[model samples]
Target: MSQMVRRLNDEIESTANMCVRNGKVELLKKVAREFRVEQKSFLEHLEELEDHIYLCFLTINRSRRLVVRLGHTRSPKHQFTLQELNMFYPTSKRIEDPGGT
Candidate 1:
């Protein structure tokens, strides 16, 4: 009877240990899943930032080309007048009046 009781106690302790180990494994899996979600979100944000940077570069290049074209004027000191600059804007967006009047 004493031997049987000892065997039962040992079995109970072993079972408890297994339960604790399984709980730890489940906790680790949950942490790993959360980390993966955060990583995916960060990558998505990075892609959006890259796209915005690419668009900004395109805008800068376009501005540089326009400046180069304008810099080819025959006169070295030829400053662009408001009228000349207005020609570059669409009629709808052109400044109607520089002064309050």
Candidate 2:
């Protein structure tokens, strides 16, 4: 697993974001070639490794970046009635088909 992680660190273009660590198909093939494994197997391993690494960073960053609820807020209480939604339709066409049927 350390070897795979090392290989990934070497292969990745950037260290700033996990999006870069998620395997591109071409990149995965290249890693597979290096490991002499079938691309499908290598890709599965890559995904698992990336998930583990990403989760580690997420855990580390969570406390520093955590958002706190600052104030009391309530969900919107207003509900739109059917008539309110009918403003877009022409009032002259009252047959209820709206589709002009």
Evaluated with lDDT, which candidate comes out highest? Answer: 1
- After superposing candidate 2, which stretches have Cα over 4 Å from the reference? 1-37, 65-101
lDDT of 1 by residue, 1-101 (tens): 34655896698567656766787657556655786879788668767877897888887787677767888854788887667677556678876666855
lDDT of 1 at 95: 69
| Residue 80 accuracy (lDDT) in model 2 | 40
Alpha-carbon TM-score of each model against the true structure: 0.48, 0.29
Candidate 1's C-alpha runs over 4 A off are 1-34, 82-97
Query: Candidate 1 has what TM-score?
Result: 0.48
Backbone clash pairs in model 2 (N, Cα, C under 3 Å; residues 3+ apart or in different chains), count = 0
Candidate 2 residue pairs in clash (backbone atoms < 3 Å):
none
Q: In order, what lDDT does every prediction score?
A: 0.71, 0.56
Please give me the total number of clashing residue pairs in predicted model 1: 0
Where does the lowest 10-residue lDDT sum fall in candidate 2?
66-75
Which residue pairs clash in candidate 1?
none
